[model samples]
Target: MNFSLQQPLENESVKLVPLKNNDFDALYQVASDKDIWMQHPNKDRWKKEVFQLFFEGAIQSKGAFKIIDKSSNEIVGCTRFYDYQESDKSILIGYTFYATKHWGTGLNPSVKKLMMDYIFQFVNRILLHVGAGNLRSQIAVGRLGATKIAEESVAYYGEASKLNFIYEIKKEDYLSVS
Candidate 1:
């Protein structure tokens, strides 16, 4: 399993770099705020310890990356492909959290374009489980052309349980749109 894959993907506005230890400080600075994870199952409430745990989890996950702003060279958010099920030939892409300032600024579509383009190159399907009440994320996934497939609840942040809407986009469907 060659998970140490390095694929520097970019769009005009943002860049995706394989997250490394050196990125910890900057990533923490952006992700450390409780408000950022309000809708997230992994609520940190802006606590340092919680952010550390979040960072450690991402480090262990092979496909995680830091989302950067090209012009400003700032760490704006994080995104990743985890929960890989090789036998099913599928991977999940979520746990995406961006700063409030970056919201609704067209940065998401650019990031999605880069990620979906990259993932479609290797996987047959990409799945996204968004918080059911997180309408913002649901709309974002819909805009990316993924279809709703199922729904279920899962524990988040060790205590808070949340309902998630499962969305999937097959390679063929993505290619047709791209």
Candidate 2:
């Protein structure tokens, strides 16, 4: 099967739709809360101008998605699958953020499980890069059964390098768990 990030994915709790140019405003509404980015590498993303650049990159990536709540049919957050390395049958999933209201609600795992179930059909491994200081994200990925493999400085689109911990989950391990 072909691996295409533009494909829409969904589950009972969330729907991952291919992000469109028009989604900037609705998605931003969920992202604008300062508490949402407090632990993120770029806390200033709550600003319109800063988030505009992020929205631009997401549209350009062609692999980003606007996460929607299935029950409310409202936008809740955003995430993306990037840096696909076919040689190793691996891809990285990162740049994820959700509204503070959605935090600790199991939304991250719901969204990630949906993503993993779809992507495992085409890859052997999936990686996630979480900001080094972002303990919340680190713990979240750990709960997803991903193992920390490395730590390095990652340069996000339109942003400077930030220390990040690399977590990896192999298809076999994730499959067994599910």
Candidate 3:
């Protein structure tokens, strides 16, 4: 079977549903808080117009998910699985952001865990691109046993290229850790 990037994924705390055009408002509600994007590469994403472009790209990618808080049944953030390479059995997990209210509550790791656990079954290596200036994301990926492999300019969809740190987690290593 072909790997399905937008498959519905869930755990006890959160559920990840394929993002749709209708999800724009609910997602923007959480994304509108300036603090959520303060440390992100695209700091102006809090603005409606800027975020609209981001949302459009997410829909186009067809791999993006609107994260929901299971308890409150509210949209909490967004993430995606992109740049999958079948020959190399590798894929990228990124473009992730969350509401400030969810930060430091162990939600990031929980979300990552769900994504990693699901995707690793199809790919041997999972890659992440963290903005060079985004220290918070760097540390978070590290805690997942991912090591920075290199740094390069990454042009986010509908955004200018920015320096990013490439991190990689091999399937063997991840399995060993878990």
User: What tens-digit string does per-residue lDDT give for candidate 2 at 1-178?
Assistant: 3769878999899999999999988988988899988988988999999999888988888899999999999999999988889899999998899989899999999999999999999999999999998999999999999999999999888999999999999999998989
Using lDDT as the measure, what is the rank order of every candidate, best first? Answer: 3, 2, 1
Model 1 poorest 10 in a row by lDDT: 1-10
Better model by TM-score: candidate 1 vs candidate 3: 3
> What shift in Å separates residue 128 of candidate 1 from its native position after superposition?
0.6
What is the per-residue lDDT of model 1 for residues 80-107, given as tens digits with 9 covering 90 to 100?
8887777877888877889889999998
What lDDT score is found at residue 89 in candidate 2? 95
Models 1 onward score TM values of 0.88, 0.98, 0.98
- Cα lDDT listed for each candidate: 0.81, 0.92, 0.93
Off by over 4 Å in 1: 1-6, 155-161
Model 1 scores a C-alpha lDDT of 0.81
- Candidate 1 clashes between residue pairs 3 or more apart in a chain or in different chains: none
